[model samples]
Target: MTRVLVIEDDPIIGEMLTLYLTEEQFIVQRVESAREGKFALGTFNPDILLLDLMLPDASGTELCSQFRQLTAIPIIVISMKTAVADRIQAISAGADDFLVKPFSMQELKVRMKAVLRRVTTPKPVAVQHTQADSASMPESQLGLSLDLERRTIVLDGDHIETTFSEYEIMKLFFQHPGRVFSREELINAVRGIDSFINDRAIDVHVTNLRRKLEKNPKEPQFIKTVWGVGYKFIK
Candidate 1:
């Protein structure tokens, strides 16, 4: 049976999650503190964990970081902490995703599905290499007429340039228009530093990439939010 570990301290919330998960047909284990949660993880061997950021024994982010060394099992941090710093911290600690507190069970389930999808789905076959070069590749895919091979992004018919990291970020999205890539996944494709690159760096690179490529960076249409996960291409 598929197991889901719920690490929530609030009795009412814990029971609610248990009821919801049970109805979803998952074998559920509920724990009230970080220590119990860690113990459950070992004996239960859960496929997914719904972790609360505030725990009696340890913060969920700290716990999850340690847990990642033990297993790559998907973890979704569900918390009241919604600050950008909170989001970045949780992800850096090896969480697959984050869900702010006061979310519906429906949203919870969707995030659970996304985390499962990301961790379980096989890596996309690396974009096929081509001697044809990035310039030779189709420009329509870029949302601009950029010479991809030469690493010069064309803006208003002028060659605007991107850093190597920025170019890799663009190419990854350009290769699959409309496909979203979690920042962790993006780093993996770019510098083989999926586990090491800071998430903020990805955000910065994307910010600059959009500025160079999109006509209206404020209301960007080419790259869009996947909400609670990552970014994707729209054009």
Candidate 2:
């Protein structure tokens, strides 16, 4: 069974999520505070997390960042804050997706499935080579080496961790160096054609990728912004 950890302060909301998700055959564990949520992370070890932005102890964004540092588990922020800035903040803080409050249970389930699908799907390793050979392959102009099987990037001979979205974006950029991809195209490539992910979310993922891959994110080397068009990877 797919395990889900829901960190929501409102008793009603927590109960509703537990009831609905349980009916869908998910192993649901709901906690009422950030403290409890942190405790459950070790004990419950959920496959995915549904987090509320407003918590009794700590803000959800803080917990999001903390949890991200601790685990690669996908997080979906469920909040009453509907501002675009709030959504962007959550995504930047390592949330995979954000849903506004008063949302339909059906929509929440769809978003959950989408987030889970993106993280769970495996990318095929294109080359048949030994690990050493793969590691020694020609590096990108930015000196980054990708390992498809591990879904990680080696930068300056050090392994760097990447979120599922960031890894997908990096893989696409490397595959089509110098090709400008519109936000919609990039979104479709990483999150699927049916994805409801907004353009800004893609920007956030790219920004996160730049932080890890670029020596200076203010003036990127390989991942260049094409202004009105979108972005491109220059080899």
User: TM-score, each model?
Assistant: 0.54, 0.78
The alpha-carbon lDDT assigned to residue 151 of candidate 2 equals 66
Compared with the true structure, what per-residue lDDT tens digits does model 1 show for residues 91-132? 666666677778789878776765454333211112332445
Score each candidate by Cα lDDT.
0.69, 0.79
lDDT of 1 at 73: 65
lDDT of 2 by residue, 1-235 (tens): 8899999989998999999999999999999888898899889988888999789888847777887766667788899987887777777777777888898999888878877765652222233345676567666522667776566776655567777678878888888999999999987886666544678889888898889779899999979999999999986
Residue pairs with colliding backbones in model 1 are 134-149, 135-149
Model 1 misplaced regions, further than 4 Å: 119-235
TM-score of 2: 0.78
Model 2: which residue pairs collide? Answer: none
Measured on C-alpha atoms, candidate 1 has an lDDT of: 0.69
